[model samples]
Target: MGQVIYKERKNTNSTKWDDCLEKFGKEDLLPLWVADMDFEAPACVKEALQKYLDQGVFGYYKHSDGYEQAFMNWEASHHQYQVEKDWIRFAPGVVPAINWLLHILTNEGDPVLIMPPVYYPFKDALVNNHRTIVECPLIRRDTGYVMDYEGFEKSIVEQGVKLFVLCSPHNPVGRVWKEEELRKVMDICKKHQVYVISDEIHQDLEMSGYHHIPTATVGDYDEILVTLTAATKTFNLAACQNSIVIIPDAKLRERYDEYLTRIRISGGNSFGYIAVQSAYEEGAEWLKELLGIIEGNYRYLRETLEKELPKVWISNLEGTYLMWIDLGAYVRPEDMEKVVRDDCGLAVDYGAWFGSGENETFIRVNLATRRENIELAAERLIKAIK
Candidate 1:
């Protein structure tokens, strides 16, 4: 394994750093917002991109058989789930795929259910497409967040939810849902005949002592489940805009393909195709190293906050680099930004954005930066809250 190094992204048009001032209205703040990492992409991805550039021909391109094989092989090798190539469909990104599903699968005024304090985009996709937003917020326990099984089922039946979007290894409050948990969800949806779309972009970033279960690989969900994932999040290749949608049922695949055709998203870009293939085939070691850094950062932040700010509660990091911390004890909900940004000079995702009225005092911190930045951010937070 090679040593992981961090670089300065301040002037490089990075959304996480360079665009922070404009987005957050705070200049010179340490940005731990957004999900992308400050670390460089895996060597394999960069080398592959360079190779494509060297070809000197950037014409419209089509993915070869090998392109799809890389994804199939990666899933089987890393996740222990085997998927056929024909079941795979290319999406430029995950969020776009969600919007497409909204247009193709459901109609205006139809109800779509999502676990709240989950990914914010799930709600946006539903509302932006003129569908009803059904919220079944996850239950917060001492252990971490879990599904409200009774409430979830009740909402589905009561609201007449046509589609359910699941965030496995759920975001904001990380919890790599166990196999049993996933099975229960699948069984419930199967009973209710509610279609599901699993957003598994964070599947490969699980911590040690935990495993992520692919929603499609669970019990009896072939017809009702569709999965959306991407190497962009896994390997920090988001700028390339590549993601995969796996639909196993033939009729569902036909409908999805027709939507893609209608929207003129016929094929993938050249750079994204090459980058994903290289990442899936040769980036395993890089991923392992990256996860180690993220875990180390999580531990550092958790311990530092516990010792320095006793009343603040930091959620467990089961998966993903995002840290969800409750700052209610130290600052009022309305003053969260003032303390974290204006006072501490730190830019983080305010909890209010995840859900309008809940967890307003919580803030999400990105833990994929160098150790020094994490330490500095912790120090500033301690000072600000005091």
Candidate 2:
């Protein structure tokens, strides 16, 4: 309903902007990479943080019941998933939780399963923990990306996969998985007695005409399911370093809690708790506005590129502010950096990073920015390709 006021993030130690040279080997390129938005955080989050700042007593803090209730209320209202307070866990971010869960649920050499062309961090979490990475690549179609259910099951069977990291409303590919698909995959995992950790950080950023379904509600696999999410992604509070880890089974929670205790990590900072609680309590309308902006940016980028580059294929953005585009028709994998970065002067997430080499020709663009930024990106992309 209200207009989103865009903010400049060029020199504020922003990862998506100021670190482009370090990350993409380029400087001053129009950055359309990374998942963080180019807008200021919701009013409620900022106001809450300011209120905390106004109180100069910055000491050791503990999470209040109100903090947990806010998240529980958000889950119930937003996704229709009723979460109990005891089922929740705390993490500074989802990636760390993934790594922690990997260590908690599986052995060092145990094989972990993941769909390729997914969130790159899933691979990092698996490999960094000395786990065998098992790849079951998602099958890409005209409509969008879909699961290879048969391949998934076969990989789980052959590799003896004990942990499966799922990206619901998958990153880079931008496919908000349907209920039936979730059921099928969970059923397979249930059959194999595999533990699943669904990275749902992007759970709240669905585009118009789309709804995000929390994977925990899909089936009776709570004993083996761990849902990781964060208000940081939804409310642009990533710097707050706070995330929610929901484990329905008491035994699994106990195991995760033991790992946390062993590592001497208890919870996040006071700012993270205050910001997240405020966001879940009063940021609904702000989110509604942000989603509309993302959808508009996606439509503009798609129409501009599709009209100019006939072979360019932009995947339908069902959820998240990320867009996956195939520039293979115009550029080869070997020249992706040259065409996209050197020639077009744009910093983007290379598709190869999301997978091995199957997606070498694709590029993932972040659409959670000003419309003018998207327009500039479109113009640069079309010019470089043509």
Candidate 3:
């Protein structure tokens, strides 16, 4: 583990800080809504970017074997998932990749399935690309969320689904999917002959006891599965705009590559390539320390809120730095924005944005910040709700 440092980011044009007035309609609240970190990029990534700057040659970028090889090696070593070089495609970000994949995998008005409350962008991609959105909401348990396999299959068959977008180590409700769970879902998709896109952007953010299973590694569904992941989330390099799209099936890769070529999309910028390669090669220790910090922050928030607001439903943190808490007991759904933002003075991702109307009283808090921020958020909730 390495030393973790927290820095101020209010005036740096940060979406989390500077855009609070635009997004949350509040300027003075503690910003904890967005997914990016308040910590600096790993020391190694910064040094590599600095080296690129010192050279000062801003020319057109060419493809690099080192970038893809570094990512492949990282995936093989961390997740035990070996990827061949030819299967790789570069995207500026996961969201854009999802949109492109939707266009390639299905026709207009074709149905695509997702599990919600989920990462909202999945729905956005489907809608933006003129595809029908089919949702099989995850079954909520007192322990955590579970896949509703029967319902998922039913939705696929009834809706005439062509694609399924999966959120591995799901966002909002953080359960790192077990191997058995992945296999069950994959089996259902295989039975339905549906194409699957596993958005594994948060695969590396597992907590102390949890492990992320690459969906393709659990079975022989490679022909149907396309994996989307990145070092950006692990290394807080979102601004660099680099992500990896792994297509194990050659035909699918060919179609995706052709789509890129047709759209005149070559690759990401030079900085994105350099930053991602450096992060994948030298960021393991930094990520380990980050997971520890996030775990501690989650413990502090859960313990304090559970002790004070006894009926609050705080989902168990299995992965990702986001904590999902159901404040329905303390505040009515209609009063959520007033209580959480206006009264508590904290910015958070509203639950309604992530799902149907049922989760309106829930709030997702970003935990990848100074422990003090987590403390302040907890203190505010306790004071406002009690």
Candidate 1 residue lDDT tens string, 263-378: 88887798999999998999898899999999999999999999989998888899999999998887998898788889889989999989866589999999999999999999
* Regions of model 3 farther than 4 Å from truth: none
lDDT of 2 by residue, 211-285 (tens): 999998988898889999999999999999999999989999999989999999998899999999999999999
Note the residue pairs that clash in candidate 1.
none
Writing each residue's lDDT as its tens digit, candidate 3 over 1-386 gives: 35567989999989999998999877988999989999998898999999999999989989578999999999999999999998899899999999999889999999999999999999988888889989999988997899999999899889999999999989989999999999999999998899999999999999988999999899999789999999989899999999999998999989999999999998999999999999999989888898889999999999999999899998899999999999988788899999999999999999999996778889999999999999999999999988
lDDT (0-100) at residue 334 of candidate 1? 87
- Model 2 worst lDDT run, 10 consecutive residues: 1-10
What is the model-wide C-alpha lDDT for candidate 1?
Answer: 0.90
**lDDT of the structure predicted as candidate 3:** 0.92
Each model's backbone clash number: 0, 0, 0
The estimated TM-scores of all candidates read: 0.98, 0.98, 0.99
The RMSD (Cα, Å) of candidate 2 is 1.0
Error of 3 at 367 (Å): 0.3
- Cα misplacement distance, residue 231 of candidate 1 (Å): 0.2
Question: What C-alpha root-mean-square deviation, in Å, does candidate 1 show against the real structure?
Answer: 1.0
Q: Model 1: how far is 201 from its true place, Å?
A: 0.3
Ranking by lDDT: 3, 2, 1
